[model samples]
Structure formats: C-alpha cells, structure tokens
Target chain A: MSKAIITRNLTKRFGDFIATNAITFDVEQGEIFGFLGANGAGKTTAMRMLCGLLKPSSGEATVAGFNIFTQTEQVKRRIGYMSQKFSLYEDLTVKENIRFYGGIYGLSHQQIKSKTEELLGKLQLQQEAGQLVSSLPLGWKQKLSFSIAVLHNPSIVFLDEPTGGVDPITRRQFWDLIYEAADRGVTIFVTTHYMDEAEYCNRISIMVDGKIKALDTPAKLKEQYQAASMNDVFLQLARAKPGENNSSS
Target chain B: MQPIVIENVHKRFGDVKALHDISFSVEQGELFGLIGPDGAGKSTLFRILATLLLADQGSAFVNGLHVVKDYKAIRRQVGYMPGRFSLYQDLTIEENLNFFATIFKTSVEENYDLIKDIYEQIAPFKGRPAGKLSGGMKQKLALCCALVHKPAVLFLDEPTTGVDPVSRKEFWEMLQRLRQKGIPILVSTPYMDEAMLCDRVALIQKGEIMQINTPGNIVKSYGKKIWAMRADNMFRLIRDLRAFEGTDSCFAFGEYLHVTLHVPVEKVQAYLTPLQHGNLVIKPAQPGIEDAFMQLMQEQNETV
Candidate 1:
C-alpha cells in the first residue's frame, strides 16, 4: 500500500526544551493509525508538525505526498482535522455549518449542495438540518462534525479526542462512521485517551516523554507486553520512568 | 441514616426534565458510582445532593441534614467537586487549598493527614498558579482542596472524564484510599469501565435510573448470551451480522463485535461462511457493564 504519512526523525524544540524528539513512523493508506500518549507526552506537538500547522525545528516528513516545509498549503488541503473542543459553529444551523465548511474547503456551489444532501441523508439529520448546531445532542453533533470533516474527501482525517465524553452507544456509533471512512481508504490519524478505542486502530504508537516508546498492532503489543488488554499495555508503557528503556524496541 | 440519601428527586429546566425521580443512597465509607453519559442527570443530581441546586420535587439529605432545610449544614459537611474545575485560577495551588481550608474553618495542617498523599504530588508546584497546572495536576489540586476540610461525604463529578488512562488509574487508587479513611464517596463518570471499580453503580440515562447494583451483580444479570465475532473485514462483518435474521444486537467492543443472538452460534457461523469473511472467529463472550447498560437503555427506549 502507498504511504499516507511518513516521518523520519521528526523533532520540535522550544528554547531549551524539546517537545517532540526524533520520532519516526509511517501510516499506510486506508490504515487506522492511533497516536497514544499522556497529556504532556508531545503527541500534540508531533501531530501539529505532521499537519503542517507548526514547522518542525528539524527532520523530514510528508503528509499526502506533500513536504511539510515547502508544500504546507497543499498538505492542508489534502487533510481533514477535527477535535472534541472545536468542530462546528454553534450559532449556525446544521446545513449552514456544512455549507460553511464546504465553502472553506473550496468546494463549488454544485458540489456543496450535493455534499450537504448526502451528509444529511447519511447522518439521518434531515429533520435536524434547520436546527442550530448547539441544539443537537452531543452524539449527533459529534457525528455531524465528523461528516463535515470528511466532506471534501480528504485522503487522511485527523481526529483529536473526538469521542471524549459521549455515551457508550454513541461512542460505538462514532466508531462505525470511522470504520466507514477507513473502508473508503481515508487514513485515520487519531488520538484518544480511551484505551478501548486503542484496540480499534489497525496499528498504534505509544509516545512517552517525547519519544516513540512502542509501536505495533494491538494484538502484538498485548502479546509482547504480556498484557490482557490495550489498557494494560498503555499503563506499562506510560508508567515507565523517563529515560528508562523498558520497551524492547 | 445513610451518609447520602436521594429520594424521588426531580429537576426541570423549562421544557427539559433534567432529572426524573432519581433515588439512591450511599452507605458510610462506600464508593458509589453514578454511571452514565453526559446530560444523563449525573451532574444535576450531584448539585441537588450538594445543596447547590434545589430539586423540583422529592428530597435529599447529606449526613442526615436535609438538602433544602439544612442547606448550610449540608454545605459544611459535604465536599463537592463540580464537573468543571471550579477553583481560583489566578491563585497559586497553595493559595487555593489554603482558601478552601480557611472557608471550612480548618487549616491545611489540621487536615494534612486527609490530603497528604494527593497534596504531596502537586506540592512541588505549590507556587504555580492553578491555571498553569496540567490536566492531571489540576485534578490532583482540586481533589486536595476538596478534602482539606475533611467533610463527612465526598462528591466528585466526572473526575476522570478527559484524563488519560494512566492518570485515571492513579486517581481511582486515591479514591480507594480515601474510602478506607471512612468518607463515603458519590462519584460520577461517563466511562463504563470505571464503573467496575466502585462498590456499586447506578446505571442512569436520560435523567432516570435504569438499575442499581454491585458491578458484578449487574453483569451477572445481563441474562443473555453474548458472543464475540470478528473477521478480516470488520466493517463488512458488522454490517452483515446486523443484517442477519438471528442477530439481536451487535456493537463493537475492542477487536470483536459483542453480539447478542436469538439463534444458536452455529447458525451465525453458517450464515457468515458464505459471505466470504476470511479468518472468521466467533466465540461465547462474557457480558460487561457496558453491554448491560446498552441492554437496559434499549429496553427503556422500547418502553417509551
């Protein structure tokens, strides 16, 4: 499979502190790649660099065949980004938010109309199209935000803690949408605190203190760490003291 | 009287009924969990019990003090950590803890033993402002402030909602330790897995209690055979399984889909074999709190 994302020795530094240090990995097209880390573990910094939002202090990387340093705008156009905190405009109606995001992605008037119709139909939001985005349930809003993110058919979609506080049923429904996107060959680069979600990824990388401590499929990681679940694997990796090389590469 | 008793509590905001006939009680030194999703009336019930908000009907008591009649007394005897971190952001960690201690007519030194373990973790950053702390650190500081007065009961609202797994585990350990100190804790969370850590959990939804029992008992009462099904193409497998006639309910759980069936497992295997699902695996799976919660919610929806 062709590569959707690649990073070699990706590093970011602020003054004397190194936020992301010498991380290397590759995400295959259509792969569900999970980025796991604690709050201060530099996952955000590394993701920002890959998304072309922040310039790397050093190293090489490419997202959707576009170089991070030179083709930043091209990189942005080929990717979709969403986070739990910010996604849709609360003041706008559901259809209006879709149109606004469609316009932002440079979709034509005809394309925007068709996309809006398709989204409303797929999400079963036909009745809610006129409702204010803020008026919808949290689960509905999350699903709508995800649909809007992928409206432009970007090759890769980046989700930052997208399923943070929703109910169990809604959380599974959100993953169903994710599975649909991945089936369509959209590389999913996502981050989550929930370990169960970790098991859903095709492969995952756990970062510790600004380094890639472990990277593998969920099954292999469990076997390698002698753990029953991904939660145990995460705890064992994250709890290792800094500068300790407990992971067997 | 129980340390915390909520009897037929109801709250409404205009047209929306925020909580409906919510009733439960926490025994002394027990760690009782109110397990549900956001907007499930967990926070609303917490506010009512903590005397922060009045219920439209029914009653609540904290340490035998009526929530409405003895609001002031309840406030003095219960520690409430709201869903959002409600602390003096401009104040340093030490200042916030000290301020809360002073308000409760106690000193940090007086209750140092109560919050010692939690405080020492954030003490190194005592000089830093509360707003400057990380999510985990901020949570620890807030917990420390809550226990500084050493109230008779503790109320924590979604303390580990957005926290990572590692920090969430550590936070639960702290709660377990606090329970040993004989303070009844009434906590709320959106995570189903965390429900198992509590002594007992009330599976709540849409401002109503679905069931309340020990976590083990709740799982035991699922009363249905669940099977774990997986294949090379998970998306296709789920779609096919959901479309199958014998499938009752299918939801993804980690690597496999936890499916409840109306027919035998052999029938499911025979049906999927022809659909070209490679490496197909189907085995009997144990039901968890989440599975039981989903079943209860589905039943409630059908009845409504």
Candidate 2:
C-alpha cells in the first residue's frame, strides 16, 4: 500500500523554541492514524505543517503524495480538514452551508447542487435542509461538518479533536462515519485528547515536548510499556520527561 | 456527616426545563462526580448547588446550611470553580491567588498547605499574566485559586474538559489528595472514563438523574451479553449486525463495534457463517461505563 503521509526529520521552530523537533512517521493509505500529545507537545504545529497551513522550519514531509513545502497548493487540494471548533455559517441553512463549502472547493454549479442533496440524504437531514445550522443539535452539526469536510473526496482527512464535547451516542455514530470513509480508502489523521478514542486508530504516535516518544499499534504499545490501557501508557511516557514537576499523580 | 444534600431540585428557563427534580447527597471527604455530556444540565445543577442560582423547587444544603436561605454562609464554605475559566486574566498567578484569598478573608499563607502541591507547579511563572499561561498551567492555576480559601467543600465543574490527557490524569491525582485531607469534592465531567476515578458518580441527563452508584456497580448492573466485533468492512458489518435477528443494539466503540444481543454468542457465530465479508472476529466483551450510559440513554429515549 502507498503511504498517505511521510515525514523525515520534520521540524518546526518558533523563535528560539523548537516546537516540533525532528519528528518522523508515516501513515499508510486508508489507515486511521492517531496523534497523541499533551497541550504544548507540538501536535498542532506538526499538523499545521502537514495541512500546509504552516510552513515547516526544516526537514521534509509529504501529504497525500505531494511535498508539503514545494507543492503546498496541491497538498491542500488533496486533503480535507475539520477541527473541534465547528466552522460553518451559523446564519446559513443546512443546505446553504453545504453549497457554500462545495463551492469553496471549486465544484461546478451542477456538482454542488447534487452533492448538497446527497449529503442531506445521507445524514437524514433532508427535513432540516432549510433550517439554520446553529439550530441543529450538537451531534447533527458534528456529523454535518464531517460530511462537508469530505465532500470534495480528498484522499486524506485531518480531524483535530473532532468530538470534544459530544455525547457518547453521538460520538459513537461519528466513529461509524469515520469507519465508512476509511473503508472507502480515505486515510484518516486525527488528534484527540480522549485516550479511548486513541484506541480506534490502526496506529498511534505519542508525542512529548516536540518529540515522538512512542509510535506503534495500541496493542504493541501496551505490551512494550506494560500498561493495562492506553491511559496508563500515556501517563508512563508523560512522566518520563526530564525535570517534570507535578509528578504526584 | 453529609457536606452536601440536594432534594427534589427543579429549574426551568422559558419553555425548556434545565433540570428536573434532581436529588443527591455527598458524604464528607468523598470525591463525588457528576457525569454527563453537554446540554445534560450538569452546569445548571452545579450553579444551584454553588449558591450561584436558585432552583424553582426543592432545597440544597451545604454543611447543613440551606442554599437559598443561607446563601452567604454557604458561599464562604464552598469553593466553586465554574466550567469556564473565570480567574482574572490580567493579573499574575500569585496576584490571582491573593485576590481570591483576600475575598474569602483569608491569606495564601493560611491555606498554603491546601494549594502548595498545585500552586508550586506554576510558581515559577508566578509573575506571568494568567492569560499567557499554557492550557495545563492555566488549569493548575484555576485549581489553585479555587483552593486558596481552603473551603470545606470544593465544587469543580468539568475541571478536566479540553485538558490534555497527561494533565487530566494529574488533576485527578490532585483531587485524590484533596479528598485525603477530608475535604469533600463535587466534581463534574463530560468524559465518561473519569467517572471511574470518583468514589461515587451520578450519571445525569437533561437535569434528571439517570443513575447514581459506584462506577463498578453501574457496569455490573449492565448484565448483557456484549461482543466486541470487527470485520474487513466495518460499515457493512454494522449494517449486517443490526439486521441480524439476535442483535439488541449495535454501536461503534473505537476500532470494534460493540453489539449487545438477546441471544447467545454461539448463535451470533452461526449467523456470520455465510456473510460476504473478510477478517471477521467476534468475542464476548465486558461492558464499561460508556456502554452502560448508552444503554440507560436508550432506555430513557424509548420511554419518552
């Protein structure tokens, strides 16, 4: 299988601080890859670089078979992105939001019209097509945002903490959509704070202070760390940081 | 003695009922958790118990003081950390703590023992503005300010939400220490996994109590045959499982689809024998808090 993402000594620096230091990893095509890290562990910086939103200070990387630095526009066009903060027009209706996004991706007028209808049908939101996006429930909005992200049929999709405050049932359904997309050969790269969600990925990379501390499948990581769960494995790695305070836990 | 007691609390805003006839109690020194997702009325209930809002009906008492009648006294005895960060962003870390301490007619030195462990972590950056701190540091500071007064009961509303996994783990450890000091803690979280850390948890939804018990007991009461299942095409697998006659409910859990069935495991195997899928695996699985919560939610929906 071809690699969906590749990074060789990918590094990003801000002033004197090295936010992402010499990180290297590859995500297989159609695989769900979990990127785990603490708040300041440079997960976002690395993701920004991969998404072509931020330039890497050094090192080499490719996303969706395109070099992030040299072919930034090509990389952007080939990937879908979603974030914890919902980025839809609250004032717009559900159908209007879908059309707006579809247009942004440069779909033809005919293509946008059909895609909008298809999305509404898939999410079972045909009844609410004329309703404001803000009036919908949180779960519905989340599902809609995800569907919109992949509306252009990108090869890879990047989700950053996509299920932050959703209910258990909604989260369960959202994962189903993710599984559906992955089955259709869409590679998934996601960052999340929930340890349980981390187990859903085919492989996980745990980053600490701009470095990839542990990268492996959940089962293998558990065995290597002698941990009962992903949560324990994370705690073990986080505690190993040099001169780290707040170690009582 | 009970540090907190809430009886038949009800609240509504316009046509929407924020909370409904909620009642529970917290023992002295016990770390009690209110577990639910957003829009579950967890915050509404927290505000009422913290003496920040009044309920339409029912009564709440902290240290035997009524929430409405003795609101002033209760305020002095309960330390409330709202769901959102409410600390003075313009002030330095030390200044923020001192300001809170002064408001409670106390000094940082008076409660130094209570907050020393948490405060010291961010003490190095004590001179920095609160708004400039990292997410984890801001959380520690917020927790420190909450404890600066050394109140008898601590009310932390979703203290770990949006916090990194590492810091969340550490925050729970700090809560354990606070409980050891005989300070009762009333914490709330949307994360179901954190419920297991509490001595007792009240699984709440839309202002009503779904179940109140130890996390272990809740899981024990699930009493269903669940299988952790996966196949080459998970999407098709879920559809097929739902169509199977024996399936009671099917929901995705991480990489596996958790299916609770009415029939035996052997029957499920027989059903999958001729399925047009590859790499199918099914095994008997233990139910967790999330599964139990989902089951309860499903039952609640069916009844409604």
CA RMSD per model (angstroms) = 2.6, 2.7
Give Cα distance to truth, residue B67, candidate 1, Å. Answer: 1.4
Residue B289 of candidate 1: its Cα lDDT?
A: 97
Residue A75: error of model 1 in Å? 1.5
Candidate 2 chain B weakest ten by summed lDDT: B129-138
Give Cα-based local distance difference scores for all models. Answer: 0.91, 0.89
Q: Which is the leading candidate under TM-score?
A: 1
Instruction: Using lDDT, give the best candidate's number.
Output: 1
- Each model: TM-score of chain B? 0.98, 0.96
Q: Could you give me the TM-score of model 1 versus the true structure? A: 0.97
- Fnat value of model 1: 0.68
| lDDT per residue as tens, model 1, B2-106 | 999889999998878889998888998899999999889899998888888989999988999999999998889889899998999999999999999999999
The stretch of ten residues in a row with the least summed lDDT in candidate 2 chain A is A240-249
